[model samples]
Target: MTELSLIRNFSIIAHIDHGKSTLADRLIQVTGGMTERELKEQVLDNMDIERERGITIKAQTVRLDYTASDGKTYELNLMDTPGHVDFAYEVSRSLAACEGALLVVDAAQGVEAQTLANVYQSIEHDHEIVPVINKIDLPAAEPEKVKAEIEEVIGLDASDAVMTSAKSGIGIEEVLEAIVQRIPPPQGDRDKPLKAMLVDSWYDPYLGVVILVRVMDGVMKKGQQIKFMQGGTVHLVDRVGCMRPKIEQLPELGPGEIGFITAQIKEVEQAKVGDTITLAKGGATEALPGYKEVQSVVFCGLFPVDAADFEKLRESIGKLRLNDASFTFEMENSAALGFGFRCGFLGLLHLEIIQERLTREYDLDLITTAPSVVYRLTMTDGSTQELHNPADMPDPVKIDTMEEPWIKATIYTPDEHLGSILKLCQDRRGIQLDLTYVGGRAQVVYELPLNEVVFDFYDRLKSISRGYASFDYEQIGLREGDLVMMNILVNNEPVDALSMVVHRSQADPRGRALCERLKDLIPRHMFKIPIQAAIGAKVIARETISAMRKDVTAKCYGGDISRKKKLLEKQKEGKKRMREYGNVSIPQEAFIAALRMGDE
Candidate 1:
């Protein structure tokens, strides 16, 4: 491409199901970047979970070549970022790769909580944002009203906004034109040391790891040695390439360009998502800036459903960790769970996707415990440790004091539902920091402990607001907070299956929720299964599962000699997954679901 027709790189960001990926598909199709049959509803959502859930999980990169209204052919590197808060770090990294972003807002829903969050993030990252009101094909869409919403809230001109129906390809060409007109071309010094941020990467068994990077500073040749900024690790490049919308490889990649690199980099850690890579010269120990290894925010305990499947689960995680080291795992030998790993995640979606992938992708039957955030635990020795799991921590008496992680949670909703949202937050121990009105909607920011509502905050918000609210949280600081180690006892023995360390104020609600879910999930075995939540010896709540009414009444079918033996064999097979506790082999989901439904 010539100087006049270089390129403009940008990302498309919006709330869940506001048509960001659909718009992406339409954009690629209009640009002839993707063929007709190759187009899917959410083309950018390439993962099975993403397609099944109808949400973008990982950030997807696509290159588009379009002739602008000005009659100039320009290369546009489009990034589709995950709409959920769990992958916020990935979203931030995606924003880093682009010079601008398409702030997609639902025409009728107006600006949602996530939309406002992205708008703020775009400004913070210094990206030139081109606001677009998508989903204008729907009869419920109010283009003029949303145009005003974008103007009043985002402080952008209404006339500048593109009213687009990405599903029907309506006015999407204008959005592309807006990208050419508003977003700036890629800026870099090609002669300088090659530098770029590894925005996204994936592992391929046949081709090793394919790296997706946007050259931010210097030229990236087909073969060059590079170093990561965070770890100072160096690797020799084998091939530098780019992907068109069809996933085809390109010849070369340079500064002011976004493309892929293959160094036979098998591990995803080598090509981490956020790390900046630069030329390895003079054995320099450092690299480019804006690189930070993400800190895991949510944690849970996991083991295989069958004790024999433990090794299978481990191997599955090992393979997954190659692509996502962010999912940290450490083995924990619990008397109740047998052997398991204390795993960490970004948030609930991250946790769920990992579990789902393990079961569906890796074909492993697994059991997971309740999710917990890091708790600042101060020991008697005047040292601090992040208490991720309550079971692993020493006694409370050994601690002088502890601070719990807190967050400044923001929830944007329609003006009519602010009262209900506030009431719901207040019940979850939220102290209102401030509330503002934007585009006839309310943006309510509150100071809340991360443990206070991490599990059920989003669910309750949707329930209270009738699915009109969206929530996002950023770690504010650690605060002097009182939290309890709420442990669950199964069969009079403390089982990690129901342990959740929650804010002290949240004990009642969390316990009640756990108990209620447990009642629905636990099978009625030969003995009554006791479900009790306690702080030490005190049982704050309790529920009893009535004993199972004889599951083997048909053990001997007509006493047909060998046929009866086969019938009994099948019966044993059916009950193979039940957890044996004093002659009751309970179903695995009862315990697993209890942990997942913690504090919800």
Candidate 2:
């Protein structure tokens, strides 16, 4: 076992596209973790979607051996975390397992919204942060300006910041040296009982459940009995290992070491992230402070395009949940979309990632409903309920008061785009909290309804700012609002999947936009199909899909006017009767198109 002083545990934290993963690649290569032939870009990002999007979804850990200038080998455990706000929980968990963090800043872009957010989290975890100004090779890079911004905005000293171009292999040696010289080693005692923190876990087809752990107090070895403190489930450890970006078997992991273990656990749910693991026979009496349960903010329904694929969809979702514990789902059947499941996600990006994974990995076609935020409802009977789906809402008369979730959002944009960005936020019923100028950029903070920002707000911000704006938000608790459920009816029948909760003041415009979009999406039927958006007994918007006429008078050529009139009347009566009994067969494409109204 290596001495505690020779081991360093740290994570790389930065904003999206700020070269966190690239820096990881450079470190792994220089330390000879992988040979040149086997090395590639983004070696830690294993998922196809992650590589394609050039973003890290899951935080990856690797153990590297580096020979410092003093001729001493040090064991460095580096966690490469995601930079997006949707994956902030991943960053927090990584920080909890590390003693320090490399705060990477884009030399050209300077301090962004996520950069500040992540740095604050690192400070909260009491991590020793070493600033690294990355991408200095860029033509617009100004390392000195970025260093000043780090000191002014984040309050972190940047006088000794390291300058490196991760892509070109510049200043890599200094980065490794700084990690060894500056970051402190983890503190733990091997003589105590086994107390390891479960950082993350995923399901492996070959090995049931693969758990990533950081040993805090004692030794974790193969063939030992361990218990999950939160779950109270015991299992026999089958294997113990570490990742060099590839699995390397180890006989035992001592204190202050990061490694993995397979305990013959059946599912990842049994091995909760942030849970304390200890010896089953003689474990610690008190558990460590674990992470809070993740709350899903956005809710939407996922239905198979074909009814026959319902069972397949269920199996696919269950398997996906094995790896992603933050994603929650429940079996729900919709009248309009047939059998499906209602899934809850942390945010819009999380929902998109899950949907894309289901379609690409499982090869299943899906139709997603409109996304909505959770609401708290107080009943006249002095009871409270959380509303996930609008279709499941209680009677309006029984709802004494409704409170919708709110969020505190911070946006960083260039000075030129500040006008449009502020207008966009204000148009969404936002209350501006503060606005300040940092260098040539503007930082704006606003309190906006979570529902308004859920639909296409990020996309709009990106487009208006020419992709120069960075946005991040945290959910503040719910507040009382004049919210009402808007229902969409096709053929005078309400579609549960198309229902949503909206603020009363903006309900009319939102309802009208949806009704108009559906008018164009739904195909022409045999009889007139009247589509209406309504709240309670009042209709807010209406549209009609004209009937496909057969031209009953076509065969009455050269006939008298009276004969043509009689035939037309007969056909009109038949059409009216058919309108009452005919069911509008809305194609799957229509549902998909109508739900994407936010894009328009």
Candidate 3:
């Protein structure tokens, strides 16, 4: 076993597309972690979705052995984490397992909103940070400017920050040397009873459940009976190993080491992230401080396109939950969309990723409803309830007050796009909290309702800023708001799938837009079909799809006016009867087209 002083655990953290993964690839190459034939770009990212999107959704770990210039070999545990705001929790968990972090900044892009958010989390965890200025080969790269920005924005010392081009393998050795010199090693007592933190777990077709763990206090050995401190489930350790980008079995893992363990666990749920693992007979009396439960900020419904595929959808969702614990769902039936699950997610991106996986990985076609945020309602009887779906909202009269979730958003943009960005925030009912200048860029902070951001705020922000602006936000709890539930009616029948909760001031315009879109989407029937958007009994907007009229008078050209008029009267009566009894058949395409808001 390696000495504790020769072991360093560090994670790479940065903004999206800022070269975290590329730098990781360079480190693995320089350290000879794998053969040149076996090495590929983003080797740690094994998922197909991650490869296509070029974004790391899940945090990945690997163990590498490096020999320093001082002629000493060291064991390095590297955790490559995601940079998107939606996966911030993943970054946090990865940081918890490391003693230090490489704070990567794009040399041309300088510091961004997400960079600040993640650095703050690392600082909170008391991680020793080493600054790395990446992409120096880019034409627009300004390493000095970016280093100064990091010092100004994050207050981290960047005087000795390593400048490197991860793409071309420049400064790769310097980065490795910095990691070995600057980062501290983890401290643990191997003589104590076994105690390891379950960092992550996932299901395998052959291995059952594979768990990634960080040993804290003692040695974890094969064939040892271990118990989960939180779950209280005991099992025999089947295998002990570490990933060199591929699994390599080991006899045991000592204290301050990161590795994987398999205990023949049947399900991933049994191996919870952040749960403490220890020897069943003489484990520590107290458990480690685990991670906080992730709160899903956004929710929506996912239904199969074919009604008969509901069971298939259920199984697909269950399988996905085994790998992703943050995603949540519950059974709900809608009159318009049939049976489906109302799912919860960390953000809009998380929701999109899950939906895309359900479609691509499971080969299932899905219908997704408009995304919504959780709201808290206080009743007249002093009771409170959380509303996930607007269709399930209580009557307005019974709700004493309704509060909507709010978020504190930080936006970084070039000065030229500041005006449009501010206008976009104002249009979404946002209150400006602060404004500051960081060199040529403007840093703006706003407090906005989560419901407004849930729809299309991110898309609009990117369009208006020309993709130069970066934004990050954290939920600031719920606040009282003038919110109401707006329902859509087709032929006087309410469509629960089309209902949503909106602020009072936006309800009328929003309702009008939905009605107008539905009018164009619903096909012409034998009788006129009326579409209305209403708040309770009050109708705010209406549209009518005119009937397809057949000319009965075409064959009566030579007949008298009375005959023609009688024929017309007979046709009108028949149409009136049909209007009273005919049911409007709305095609599936209509629902999909009408739910796409902000496109117009």
Candidate 4:
């Protein structure tokens, strides 16, 4: 059994692209957890998409063995977490498994918006934070300046912060030494009942569902019966193993240890993140705190290009969900796009990742409609209703009031772009709350409607600030707004999936923009197609795509002008007849092409 004093459980937290993954690689190498022959860049980021994008989409846990200068061997479990705001929940779960964290900051860039946000989150979790300045070998490296910035912005003492260059492998030994000396060891009671928390999980073809958990109060071993407290399922533990950079079957995992458990679970739902794992026969009386069910904040319709691929898409989603439990989907049918699934995601990045995964992993083409936020509707009869898709909304006469979700946005940027950033925020109807300066950087806070920022706010902010600004936001309670439901009509027929809720003030301009975009994308057919945007029964914008004309007069070569006129007359008559009876076929790309008409 490993002694508790020699076991250190910690996580590395930092903003995106700040050398977190590279530092992780160096630590894993120098510690001999994995041989140099087995070493690779971003080894913990196992996903191909993650490696290609240079971002950590999922949390990875690894065990490392290091011997300090004090002549003592220590076992370290490092939880590598995603830094993007969309994966904040994943970061929180990773932090829950560790007692300490390495706060990595870029030497040149200093502290960013996400850096402070995650630092405060660590403070909330009461994790011991050891500030580290990375990328010191860069041309712009300013370790001393960053150390002072860390003190000013995060209010943490950084005089003893480790300065290292992950690229050159400098100070790698000092970082490991700091982990052994500064970061406290994990503490728990081995005599207590089994009280392990499921930090993360994945599905394996041979072993079924595999779960990575941190044992808090008891021992876990193979052939033991375990109970998932929140999932309310019980099963016998078929295997218990620890990840020594690879899956190694262990005899038993005791307190303060991080490892995996396979309990013959066929379905992923049985092992949920944030759920407690205890003995089935005599489990602990109370479960761990801070257990929250993941909720989808943004929703959009995902239709296959070919209607026959609906079942294939559905099966693909099921397999994806076996690993990722954050996204949700349901059966949906669109008048223009045919049958599909209405999917829900944590945020825009999550939505994009899922869409890309569906295309790449399942080999199916997809068309996604404009994303929308959930709204709360009040009926005239005092009944409350939850609305995800605008098409499901009731008539205006039967509605009393509608409430849309809101968010608290925080932005950090250089003082030079303050004017443009503030203007952009105000244009989005963001209410300025406070503004302050810290370490030569400006931090601004605003309360904005979630609908406004869900689509174009990030892109616009980056454009206005020249990529110097960083953003982070959290969902606040819903607020009442002057919102209206805007519907799109193609060929005089309303598209249910294309309906969206927008503010009444900008509805006309946005609707006009959508109509114009659709006109350019929709192909001309035998009959002219009129695309219109309307609110309730009133039309707001309209555009008509002219029909494709054929050279019927070309066949009348070497004839008199009268003969050409007669041929034209005959072609017009045929077109008129076709217009009366023929239907316009709008391709799937037309609906998707209009989704980029900005946030409405």
Candidate 5:
């Protein structure tokens, strides 16, 4: 085994919007992993939803080169972790890939809820942490105050933490030197067989499954046979690729190096995150360290606006799932939505990413329902079934017992919004556990059912709190609840997007809003759309979406009969595209926007 001193590894950890992606961009560029010409802000984050929303949804690794103050060139592996609680498991996996972490605290915002959660997680993972105050270039920057907060929270000295503006490129050099000095290098047996943990992977039009792996032992070479441990699959090595910051196709990978090895792996599940990739007969260590199996926490239904596009949506999801391990799927048939899939995700943001990618990246028009959390139901006979769409929920009488997942939710917000935040949490069936005061801000921890946060809670929290509330939650366990699964129907047909599991009392408002949103989102065609909310047999609420009444009444009047006939044909084509099976008339943006929204 090589000594650990040669490998320098660390992860950039922070809350959403805290410059995690920006700092990664700087580190990658400075380390010469990516060239100026190849530089794209947030290059490590590839998902469109992630870049557009200014957050890192998955953890990414890029190897970089740096020169110490004494002129020694050292290899620095920078692990960029997701900045939200929904992705805490991901951050933990990233932590396993490194020996140290750069805990980024926003200078202007001080320590937010997510930042604290990640720092604690890093500590729990036993990775040495180096605190850094970012956004120092902002006019309201208070580096010293944040430094003190970090010291107080992490129980470490604050002097070593550097203040830097990743955007202005200030103090970046110093930060680089600090990483080399504070973080230790990777140590592994070079003589053993090759074994590495798959961290993140992406698909390029040219190179498929551009995988990022942290080598655990031995060496990887071109044209070698490999097997994935978790899924028990094998791949014939195509070519070994190295990314010394900017990606380069290489002939081999040694211990301590972070790179990719592709072997024409067509199926994404075969090569998955946290899976150990080793030689078929023998490879380094014969086993890998620190691979965590990832699971889905949130679920949603994906339906194409045009039923004919059902097959198209399914194909897009399959391709999307190739590189995105967090997205999963099972075919779902809805009396309302027709044939679709009940897709699983890591979190709400995860669900949105898949939906957006399908509509925006794949150029497929779709209608997604309100996001929902899965419920574990134990039948009276002890049989178990996990519920995703509310429609599939067994009848309450048959269920005998149902345990909805609960999360220990921590909401951080300014003092002014504390009362509203508390009230909102309480109304969502949240049980207040504790509240802490930090400067003029507050952090409130509560235990709430996952069903609450999966739907309108996210939107309501942001709205009532004026976007000041930051949220983080990890599953605590499940709790017994008098729950009702609210299923929505259009013209008496169930639409998966409108399904939800709501408390008995809140069902009315949730169903009303869901139906209204559907009425606005589902397009109008030759027939009007009727949206209804029903709890089993009886309908509690209903709304209507009318067909297009006056679209293009003009063209036929000024043209010849044949031309007028052509116009009618074009109009019919337009209707076919806009029409859904239900009683709603909507446009494309409305469909995408509806998917982007959650009715609180």
Candidate 6:
């Protein structure tokens, strides 16, 4: 077993595509953790979606043995974390398992919104941070400017920061030396009662459910009985293992070391993330602090394109939920969409990842509805309720005030596009609280309604900023706003999944835009269809879709007036029957397309 002083647990965090995974690959290669034949680009990002999108969707941990210049071999447990704001909870869990962090910043892009947000999160955890200026080999790289910004913006001393190009393998040795020299070794007593934190967990087909944990106090060994502090469920440890890129069975995991353990657990909920694990015989009296239960912020309805696949979709989601505990779903019935599930996610990117996984992994065709934010509903009887779906909201005339969740948004962008970015933010009902310049870029802070930004806010921000802006947001509690539920009615019938909560000031314009967009998407039926956007019983916007014309007089061309009149009467009778009994068949694409009205 390695001494505690020779073990260093750290995580690599940065903005998306800022060379985090690339640097991780370089580190893994440098330490001989994986041979050339075994090494691949973004090796830590095992998910196909992660490699295709060039983003880390999940937190990955690996153990590396490196011989430092000091003639000492150290056990380095490097945890790579997702950079998107949606995965902040996952990032925090990763940070809790580390003693230090390498804050990677792109030399060309300098400091981004996520970079600063993650740096602050690291600071809050009191983790020793080593700022690394990456991509120095690029033609546009400005290491000096980036180094200065790190000091000025992040308030970290950058003079000692390692400047490296992960692609070119430059400064790889320097980074390894820095990790050994600068980052403190883990400090914990091995004689204490067993205390470990379950940072992450996933389901394995053969091994059942496996959990990645950081041993904080005592040793964890195979055959030992353990109990989850929060869950109060006990189990016998079937295996104790370490991640040598892949899980390798370990006889025991000592204090300050990271590894995985399975106790024959089958359900993912049994081994909860951020929960404490201790020996069942003699465990610590109190659980660890900073345990956070993951909650979903944005919600949407997910339905199978084929009605017969409802049960299949449910089974697929159940399997997925075993691996992803953050996502939540419950059965829902829709008027337009048959049977489906109302799913909740962390954010937009998270929602996309799950959808992509369901499609690719489970081979399911799905139709997703517009996203909605959780709202607080207060009634006249001094009662309160939380509404996630718009259809679940109470009546507007509930005799009391309604409040919607608000967010504190922080955006970092180039100075040249500051005006347009701020204008876009204001248009989204953002209240600008402050604006400051970091280096040559602008850092703008605003308090905006969460409902406003949960949909197309990120895309719009990227558009107006010319794709040079980075955004991060956090909930700032609920605030009373002029909120209303806008519903889309096809042929004067409301589609529950298409209903959304929008501010009154922007409701009319948004409703009109949605109605017009849906008009082009929904195919013309045999009878005229009226697409209307309504708030309660009041129709705020309307668009008419004309029926496809088929001339009934063509067959009676110059035959006779009586024959022509008879054919016309027959057509009229058919049209009346169609209007009375024929329901509009909205394709799955139309429901999904309704959410993309602002994409163009």
Against the true structure, whose lDDT is highest? 2
Residue-level lDDT for 546 in candidate 3: 94
Candidate 5 per-residue lDDT over residues 1-600, each given as its tens digit: 224565687898888888888988888877767668989878888777888899887677776767788787787778888887767776776777788999888899888778878888888867878888899989999888887777765687888788899999998998888888887777777887777887766665676666677787878887778887776777788877766555678777778777777778666566666678888876534455566667788877777778898878878888887767677799988665578888888888777677777888889876675577778888988898888777776677888877788999888888998888889888888899998887778889999988878866878889988898888888888788888877777666665545667788888887786677767666665655677898877788889866666555474556567886776788777666555533443454664565555543
Please tell me which model should have the higher lDDT, number 5 or number 6: 6
Q: How well does each candidate superpose onto the true structure, as a TM-score?
A: 0.87, 0.97, 0.97, 0.94, 0.84, 0.95
**Poorest 10 consecutive residues of model 6 by lDDT?**
552-561
Candidate 3 residues lying further than 4 Å off, grouped into runs, are 558-560
**lDDT value, candidate 1, whole model:** 0.78
Which model, 4 or 6, shows the larger lDDT? 6
lDDT of 1 by residue, 120-199 (tens): 87788889888888888798989888888778877877787888888788998799889999998877765666678888
| Residue 38 miss distance in model 4 (angstroms) | 0.8
lDDT of 3 by residue, 61-128 (tens): 99999999899999999999888888776677778889999999999999999989999999998999
Off by over 4 Å in 4: 525-528, 546-580
After superposition, the stretches of candidate 1 with alpha carbons farther than 4 Å from their true spots are: 1-5, 282-286, 490-492, 508-532, 539-589, 596-600
User: On lDDT, who's better, 1 or 2?
Assistant: 2
In order of listing, the candidates' clash counts read: 3, 0, 0, 0, 20, 0
Give the per-residue lDDT digits (tens) of candidate 4, residues 291-314.
888889999999899889999999
lDDT for model 6, please: 0.90
Q: For candidate 6, what is the TM-score?
A: 0.95
CA RMSD of all predictions: 7.5, 1.5, 1.5, 2.8, 8.3, 2.3
